[model samples]
Target: MTPRIVILGGGSVGMYTALRLQRRLRRGEAHITLIDVDSYMTYQPFLPEAAAGNLEARHVVVSLRRVLPRCTILNGVVDAIDTSRHEVEFRPHKGPPRRIGYDLLVVCPGSVSRTLPIPGLAENGIGFKTIEEAIHLRNHVLGQMDLAESTQDERIRRQALTFVFVGAGFAGVEALAELEDMAHDACRYYPSIEPADLKWYLVEATDRILPEVGPEMGMWTLEQLRHRGIDVRLRTKLESVKDGRVVLDDGSAFDTDTLVWTAGVKPNPVVARSDLPIDGKGRVRATPFLNVEGYDDVFTAGDCAAVPDLTRPGEFTAPNAQHAVRQARVMADNLLATIRGTRRRPYRHAYAGSVASLGLHKGVAQIYGVKLRGALAWLIHRTYHLTKMPTLNRKVRVLLDWTLALFFRRDITALGALTDPRREFEYAARTTAEPVAHV
Candidate 1:
């Protein structure tokens, strides 16, 4: 009988792994089934660009059906897995739960935002993970500007103009900078709302930001942000955001309607529930070969697995897209090797470097010990990620968007109605059903 290969999640690892497997696997060699709740895989590095209207939302996501048409795509979530029985409990988007059997398993559920319990954080704070969150944030930021500009109430205007972002990691910093730039550019349209009125605050619990880049670059980036008049609160924690009132550990208090959470991410909770052996950090224990420990048939990678770093002894690869993409290649090859009875290579790659875009034409990069800043860094950031982005389809669209930006200004439209698109129709239906008064 042919082997049944089941892949869980459709992020960086799962998507690329399946993409490779489907290409290499012969007819009847193995049956590939990929399970993910979302039908599309989001290229997350461009999420800030998407949010800032640099790239269209649809362009940033690759349709799984389009890319992995050869593999079976199940639009569902894996609730549980009984490794002993070689079965996984799957909960479809809209149906009864069922168990799926497989000969070989690929666990790549990825990570969820690691949020701390601060007062009113859950209600007020939104994460920067999904494409929805990114787009919604864009609308919300622009909407807040609209509210500030139109409002006569001083307190409300103040609150509306103030934007607070917690966790100064890549996600936090990039988002803050992009949105701030957008809002500033938008101020020209709103005569009352000056750029100075927009009070942007970036709060990080640590002393530094963008730890991926070296300390010198990180410090330079910090200086650049502060120079732009952004309030950088290092060694600070969000004490609370109760009722849109922001409080900080540094004894600062303010009111802001916008609070973005980009603290960190941990392994998906479902991993723990599964039978896989997990490390202390709540990730699957993965060997250098990209297979789960003590399980030859079962493999795991990406943020959910603690993959050992061969270059740096006693260290696991950091949970990032860089490592995840590389790991997927090795995992797919090893899976094929296992089936063909061939040699399987261990997943090993030294840190390539980090590149981050601050705003339109501003960025920082450190590629192979060469540190670059400003417009040149920005170009490198776009160039590097453009190549890595899956499919020529998406790459062309992203490039077109950037090219268009060169000639045109950012589309700062706040389409908040997209959030609840059916609201108007539903309201009309409800009102029309009632008896109409004859005039």
Candidate 2:
């Protein structure tokens, strides 16, 4: 029998590992399997653009089956890993639990949206991680405008136009910038909507936003956002969103219809379930080579794995697309080396800098000690992600979207009804279709 290689969580690391393994290992040398809850591996960097109507939502995600043809793709979440027995328990869409035994296990379960216990947040706040959430937010924003224009109630209109985003990291800043830009542009189509009528608020508990880009860039970003009429409330914490009332810890409250949470992320809960050593943040502890501690047969990578940063000595690699993709390559080579009895190498990388897009023609980037802003940064931002995007097909389509966006108005159509196609079908079933008289 061939050696069994099973990978959990088909995110970037998991998918990339499968790709590299397919290229290196012979067809009959080893059997590789990839498991994930979702069928598509999302390019998270484009989520903001997808929400802003810049890129087609579908184009930002890569199909696992299409990308990893040689590897057996398992569409399910890994519930638990039995390291002692070399087996994994999985549950797929209400199906009974199934166990898959493996000789070598790779855990890259990825991360989940980190949420806090704020009043009414659980019911009202929308997350910015998934494509579904992005699409939903787009519809909700547009729908709020429609509701405001049609309704005669002043309070309701005010709430409808108000938008709030918590956290000021790259996701929060880019999302705030993009949505503010999109809303401003969209207001042109709404006869009754004034640009001032839409209130865009960004709340950051820290002293600055976009800390990944350093202090100077962060200050510049704040000024740029404020110049665009966005309320950048730094060093402020959100107290509650109870009943649509946004209460801030600084003794401020406002009624708002939208609340977006981009605070941060924690590793997938599956890591905690396993007996593997985990950090306080729930990340699996791994050496620089991406091998799990005390378990030679197990390897981990991406956001879920705390692969130590050899360059930094004590710090683990930061959880970002840049690090995840790089780690995946190293993990793949190390795995192959293990199989072939070759020497394994350690993972070592330095920070290459960061980039954040603020809308159509605005952005900030710092690379190799060079600072970039405005359209140039925006162009660089697009160029970098385009190169990093998984497949050539996706890259070409994203480029086409950007090219067409320059000539055409952003598509603001909110197909909220798509969320529940059955609702319409049920309505039509009751209204239009003639009932078979007890046939």
Candidate 3:
């Protein structure tokens, strides 16, 4: 019987690892099966572009079935892992749970948005993580513009035009910048709404934003955002959001129709459900080789695993796409080495700086100790991410989208009906009589 390898999560780490393993293993040497809740893995770096309608939603996601044809792809959630029995219980998308034993288990379930217990957040706040969220946010923003334009009441108009975004990390900053740019561009279509009428706010609990790019760059980012008329509130905390009224810890209060949350992420709770050796922060305790502690047959990587950083003593690798992608390569090679009885190389890669896009033709990057800003940084950001995007087909599609965007005006059409497609049909069925009744 061939060795059965089960990999969990279809995110960057999981898909990359499976691809690497497939290339190294011969037929029947190992049977690789990948399981994920979603059929496609999202390229999170392009989420801002997707939200801004700069790239088609489909182009930013990689289909597991199309990319990993040789591997057994299961669209399911890993319900439980019984390491003693070397079996995993999986809950498929539309069926009862099933069990499959594995010779090796690779856990990379990735992370979920970390949220606070602020009032009304569960119902009012939107997260900036998945493709669905990005699309919804685009529609929602446009829909808010529609609402603001149609409303005659000053209070309702103000609420509809006001937008609040929490967190100032890369996700938050890029998302705000891109969406704000899109909204500003979209204002041309709405005769009633001027760009100045739309109030945008970025609130951060810390004094600085974009900590990944250092203080000088963070300050530059702050100045750039403020120059665009965005209210950047530092050392501020969201106290509550009750009844659509936003209350800040600094005694500021506002009513806004849009509230976006992109604070941070925590390891998937599924890791704790398993019998894996987890760290204090609820991440799988992974060695430098990306193998789980005290488990020879089990391996973990990505946001779910706390892999030690050899270059930085007493610090684990930062949970970012850069680290996740590179770790997948190293993890795959190390796993093969372990199986083949060859020397395993430790996973060690120094931080390679950061890049962030601030709307169109505006960005900031720090690469190899060299810093960049403005249009140059934006160009590099696009070039780097374009090359990093998985699969040639996706790359071409994204490039085409960008090329088309240069000539055509931004599409601000909102498809709010998508959220509830049956609403109009149901209303028509109730109000309109069937023509067949005449027969």
Clashing pairs in 2: none
Off by over 4 Å in 3: 434-439
Please give the lDDT score at residue 41 for candidate 1: 98
User: Model-by-model lDDT, in order?
Assistant: 0.93, 0.90, 0.93
* Model 2: per-residue Cα lDDT at residue 336: 90
Q: Write the per-residue lDDT of candidate 3 for residues 158-275, one digit (tens) a residue.
A: 9999999999999999999999999999999999999999999999999999998889998999999999999999999998888899999999999998999988888887898899
TM-score of 2: 0.97
Q: Report the C-alpha lDDT of model 2 over 172-268, residue by residue, as the tens digit.
A: 8888898888889999888989999999999999898999898999899999999988998988999999889999998889999899999998999
lDDT of 3 at 75: 90
After superposition, the stretches of candidate 2 with alpha carbons farther than 4 Å from their true spots are 428-435
Query: How many Å off is the CA of 295 in candidate 2?
Result: 1.0
- Alpha-carbon TM-score of each model against the true structure: 0.97, 0.97, 0.97
Q: What digit string (tens of lDDT, one per residue) describes model 1 on residues 1-439?
A: 9899999999999999999999999888999999998999999999999999999999999999999988999998889989999999999989899999999999999999998889999999999999999999999999998898899999999999999999888999999999988888999989898888999999999999999888999999999999988999999999999999999999999999999999999998889889899989899999999989999999999999999999999998988889989999999999999999999999999989999999989999998999999999999999989999999999999999989999998888899999999999888988896677899
The 10 consecutive residues of candidate 1 with the worst lDDT sum are: 428-437
> To one decimal, what is the Cα RMSD in angstroms of model 3 from the true structure?
1.4
Candidate 2 lDDT: 0.90
